[model samples]
Target: MTVDSRIIYGSWNLEEPTTPTRSRLFCLEPIGLGTAYVESLTGYVARLSETHYVETGMLILTQIGPLMKEGYTFDGRAGGIDKLYGRYTRAFNGASNWTSALISALEHLTLRHDLKFLSVLPWVEVIPLRYLLRPSRAWCPVCYQEWKDAGKQIYEPLLWFFDAIKICSNHHYPLCTKCPYCQKENRPLDWYSRPGYCSKCKEWLGTNQNSIQTDLGEPLKSDLNWQLWASENIGSLLATAPSLVCSPSKATISMAIAAYVEGTSEGNVSSFANKVGIEDQQIHRHIKGKTFPSLKTLLQLCKHLEVTLLKFLTEEPTVEDLARASARLPQLKNSTKRESFVIRHNQSSIELALKEALLENPPPSVTELSKRLGYASSGPLYYHASSLSYALAEKHLDYERVRRFEKMRSILESTLQKEECPPPSMQDVARQEGFSVQLLTTTFPELSRAISDRHKEYRQMLKTVRIEKLRQEVKEVAFQLNKQGIEPTRTNVSNCLSKPKSIVMQAAIEALQEVRHQLGWEG
Candidate 1:
């Protein structure tokens, strides 16, 4: 019997189906996506490096650095790598140009379009970079330990990167800045950083199993409530990012504040400012869309206005809701009575205070004078006694210049005299003293040069030491393989070493040849 030709030819359209291109790297999904605890872009990079069995710095230098178009390049040398990882890594999680470039590079590598959600890039238009991100890493030990115990991936969340997020909303404990073992703060992304481990010491950062009941020095009830509110609201904002039809704008924020001002204070900005504890001029600037409030200030505004941060940015309050919110303004004003206390100062009292301040030794700063005069800031003092305020400020600046110079000189001379091993670099001293390396070099060129020279010598010594240790390790591994009747080949020797990645293959090959010669083996 013949088969039916219709069965073979039925619905045969000879068009080739289009297959999507494969990504170069694994497209690992970010943890807690669409939630406040979403994994940070830096955290995602660290995890990706681990998956590929390469150092994070190496991955960045090899794969992502070349893809960046904005002249963001990493030096492959050790010192340059250290500088990048130690000081410049914080920008990876922020809304800077580097963050945008890295996101584009990673998306190209992973072929995933959703990587921008891992950073604050989506909100860059409305969020100012100043005071936005923390300089160092912060984490909740309880959260780390809990995730570890549950065998969950211990990635850092984007929420912990915010400078405003001091406490963990879920754990209600203050986030830790320094490592428990090393007592050293770590950068947001280190060269060989791993999740749940100290980047410097490689020690576990999670809470100890036996110290589960340790006191965390909880804050007062009122302060704790505010911290919780700020953290939760900020988290809500991050969680709502993926679903936003359009990014939040300054106009939207301005309209919201303007609406509130009209409703609560009947278009009286000063009255509304008094209720909100923000300066009227600052409120005016915000309403005019000239500038945006910082994240901390924005959170405070939302809390006092009885609106969620997500709603305040995304939706405008209706007239009725604003009326109800305004009705509660009386209670807010009453509650802030202590904060709204106005200090009455006349012209005579201000002039008398300035005269006495001028004669005082170790002249007080304008800010100090303001506090002593019962004014909130130096603005009022300058307004009333312009000449006196200027003179006082100049004197204080001169004094401070001499004082700071002496302090920095003493610290630099002391650092040079110290007999510590692995001498600290100029960058280290600058970071520890909260000064910039450029400032130090410009101010004290000789001392900065000496420090740099000493650090270079120490680094050379370390390199010599590491080379010797690596040779010894390679020799040992080669001998062991030979004794096992196996060829001391490079691959075999490397596989036998404890840390195969730490050995330089050329050094290992040379050591293997020496071992083979010692064993009376032919080449």
Candidate 2:
């Protein structure tokens, strides 16, 4: 595909489809002033060495170098370049400066031949080499070979603009420009510095509100509609890009994963690396070797993968999938569950160490137990203790909570063997069985302080509920007395209260219910 240099010159200044128009093309527009013009497709930019300052210089050479011989006209120049020197040479007043410009021109032209001008901002996107080709001139950055239809040429400025956005110093919203804590650290480039925190001793103290947002200057967001659009378009941008490699795989998988998990395409190996606190190279090496990461590395992987490290490094995932999982894992419960698991694993491990120690002449102390077991601190043992506490409470194991539950079971069995029916009241049952209500409440049934508090609340509600039931029972008993030709009124109930014995209350309640049933007043 030979691009006629003359065609470029003719279209250069025709009427740019965009502003900040290709200045290099503007410089050559007049060289084809007398030729028959071909009005380019609306957004076509002239053969572009890319929009870089250096590439523009190459376009100046290709567009002007040949035209200069016949005496090219001087005109369309933007932002100071070569004079229309005798053609281009005559315009230069001094030999040294002209030679310097000549050298810059040659150097630029050489570089443009292989230049892969990336069109992107902080995160870059490489412009396709095809979009950048021009057979007669340098290449045109605007001509995309993968056009939807031959006749309807649409140039996605946003595509090019985002590249510019990534590299530009001005867009301040996706990331803040001023770190309220440290004014020095908020550019897009600063993102790699640290998960930035405020230097100012504010309440957040070492915290950052780092949510990526769109640039405020943007009138609309591409993200809202880009999902479906990307379903069609990302394939073009993603086709086997080297930067996208996750081992031998193209970046599409990483990008697809990030979209699924993070609801965006911000996933790439480097982004994963940053979260894991390992250089991308290390992760590449680990996965490339078909190896699993160490435990610490596993946790880091989980931070971004949104899975536990065990699942991440294991051959087959063991999922404990549930909604509100994020809520379930506050530091307290997570640490607690972790402590229990660690304690159980360690306790089994510790028993082995103890057996070995007992084989020696002198057994090791509890402190030495950890050293022999290769544990870093006594904290692991303490973590185990906490684990036991929960197990004892839930009665899940025959440990603490289980011991109390069983003890309570034993007492109830013994009392039942001795008496036909103990009174149902809490104090009466305790008194008859030689049990202390306080000890029973606190120990054998061992409700933790939290459970005790919860019970207190339940007791408050039960106070009203229990009192009403008791009153109904008393009424039935009194009615039974009346049916049997004895006084059974609220006033007569004082005698039962005065009698002071749970057995008396029991007899009264049973008789009342029996009488109430006969009277068609079910209790």
Candidate 3:
């Protein structure tokens, strides 16, 4: 070639040069991308902070928070930071608005579009948010230890955040909620949280022992079997997220349930419900696309119907496949007996029971009334006395509404009466009372508003107090630096404070100027 041509060209093309765009943050690849142990978004944040040698809260407040449409704020106080990492942080790994926002912000920072797979956001349409994620952190010590020992990165998996996953599939060990050292339950992510360490005590959470011993009593074989099934299936569902062509929809699950009912129970929804031991109303709601079944309920349905949850959600089964699956389940002898009992009871008896139920001081629910009437379900009572049943149901609903309102009102009033500095937020109160924020606000508008107003005022007061405290500390630090002939500069003064990051630099600069004027060293 050298002899044949004046210049010999290599295989590489030098004329067309390509330059790769840089990411604002490190493009750290998530662990277990398509596996059951995929890294959680919360864990990814913690890891990213560690890589940058900054605290998790600082990373969020400085780099990521500003990018989010709903900006995150911290008052440079411990209490305010605690609220940032409280129960809402659990939603980071779930299919919630918070998760979606975080995913968008992180993808923008890292230029990695696969961040959505770190959460259950892909299945948001089919998975209900209620009871979707664990309230706090849960992990397997053995898994952590093993990963550390193998020189692999320690991370919290998205599977561990699932409220339904109790056991680790690989080790068959129960996941630990409380830290072994401190015995305290940690939020999913805290300001100083790090993977494989207790957020409270900063102790290593992983165990070095080959066989980890737990305080939890041995789980029953049947319970373990069910737990394992749920864990493995949910894990498989997560693993399939990246490969899914389209996100599964509520209609897909509804159609699957409808097909199964049609094939197994001759299109009688009640019969299918009875066979699966789920409420007929729940089945109807699910089939009508009104509400999706919770993850636990969906798993229970899949278990009884002999269908994998992944398949039940992703693909609709044929009639023959449903029939075969139904054939595998044992005959429901109790269901048949209950159905016959309901049929034999006279409609007159049901009407009489409904009339009596309406007269009770505290009305019994229709289901309870049905049980008292020796009926398996409320369907028969409604069928026999439609108008009376409707009236009774409506009355019971009214009673429930009043009772719940009073209970929430009482609790909220008590909360307001407390002398705690920095009153609890309405969200926290709602969570403690086991109600939704909307329900709390709508049911007791005045009380909810008062509580919210009190919290806002207290928070504002705390912010003012903290800023003053920070300013004083900065002045003292600057004075000390000046006495030492160190030139009371911003950097020097900051280095002298106990928590320099907590002070607003602008405030610090003003304080430093005041100190300099007092010392007759004005620039």
Candidate 4:
């Protein structure tokens, strides 16, 4: 039976409404204390559906509304019904922003008093979709076991869904993606999917906590420590999302990156990409608002780039604000990794190096400058003098780009004027120049035009040479046929020659006509 399209209200309502109508069907408290923060949308919906003995499918129709009515669906892949929150916000509360819509959804659906604790919704607007959430759910077996042991309702924390977090900060264990019993992966929005239990086979997901210790190497341990730090910081940032006066903007992130990699080899986007193992093109896209990073990728970049997550997310965090947060990170006493921590106490040597580097004839790059001054990475230059370092790097990168363009133009122009051999085509020139054709055209338009003109003449000269070569081959074949007492007709000569008829061209036709006139065989 088809349902009517009008928005349904009063299908169910509370009798003698309590000030904060906490659901009685299931007294599930938010995972972190008595706060209103629920860990994930999957957990929240699963608990709500369980109270009514319904599955995810029924919850969508009854709770999330119909496809045509509100354009809501049970399966939105990784984003999962987050879109529904927006629709519900517009429909009932008439709220415009995602943060308000989220608060409205919690109040309307479950009436949970802990609406203020839910951090994900508040942060939904600020974080780019790439770093916001993951498609498949991740669970820490230790966390599940702890929740079960405490007699608490089993649920997934919103923290696990962030792509940035791989290891559990509490246990230092990696997250699990599959059910222990059935060994199958489950999507968070599956029709019958339940939190803390396998969607298939209905097995508990907490039993597969392996006792094996994760010890990859020194580098991996350092990475694990960094991951643990990031988990806590990012998690705390989300937890406080509801109370933030103004959300962190993309400009804030750009500010942090520009501040840290100054006066170093890793100052420019290309070098930064190499240092961080991300594509330079992607870095360009992210800065330009063309795309965004995933949460995991963003955190990894933060760790390597030496910018604290707190500062990056904070709107106009002071130098002291960054120092306080950075000081908490574990320092490597002996390791050679470049530290980007803010150095406010004494910066005389740093200042001297910057001055010398800036004054050099061919300005010493951040990386080269760092090497000469006995530094491992370029992070410190930005840490101490962020604005100046960034300005210098930007100026140097632009200067270097122009210098390279001029050098390439000179090389190409000189190559074209060479009298020893014919000028190479653009493709050949690009191969010798070690640049892409697109780069050649886009970065060096004037040179591209010069190459085009030279290329046209070069092609014509090659064509003439090929025709003369074909003409010589045909004449030799015709002479050979005549010496053997075989009539050198056009068809006979064509057969006599090994070259294809197409390549024989007008030269072959002229040769055949002359041979015919000499032999008086013009029929």
| Least accurate 10 contiguous residues by lDDT in model 2 | 114-123
Best by lDDT: 3
Better of 1 and 4 by lDDT: 1
Q: What's model 1's TM-score? A: 0.61
Quantify how close model 3 is to the true structure by its C-alpha RMSD in Å: 12.4
Candidate 1: tens digits of C-alpha lDDT, residues 1-523: 8888668655778999999899999988888889988899898998999889988778877788766532234435455345444465788888765676678789889998888888887787677879899988899888999898899999999999898877778766778899988899988777777778888998998994367654446453447788888878878877988988978766566657766875676555677787888998898778655788988888888888788887887775666657777876754433232432244687678878998998989999766776776644454455456577667866876788799988889889999999878798876898799865645767999998898789878877776776678889888877787788988877777777877755455665677778889987754
Tens digits of lDDT, candidate 3, 42-141: 9999999888898887787667775553224534545634444456787788876567667878988999989989998888879888888988899998
Ranking by TM-score: 3, 1, 4, 2
Q: Model 1, 94: alpha-carbon shift in Å?
A: 1.8
lDDT of 2 by residue, 328-353 (tens): 32222111112111223445664555
| Candidate 3 wrongly placed segments (more than 4 Å) | 1-19, 69-80, 83-86, 209-211, 214-218, 333-523
Residue 465 Cα positional deviation in candidate 1, in Å, after optimal superposition: 38
Report the lDDT tens digits of candidate 4 across residue range 96-193: 23333334444556556555444354454346654355566788887787778788787767777766677888777778888777788766555566
> Residue 26 lDDT in model 1?
96
Best by TM-score, which number?
3
Q: Estimate each model's TM-score.
A: 0.61, 0.16, 0.64, 0.47
Tell me the TM-score of model 2.
0.16
Indicate whether candidate 2 or candidate 3 has the larger TM-score.
3
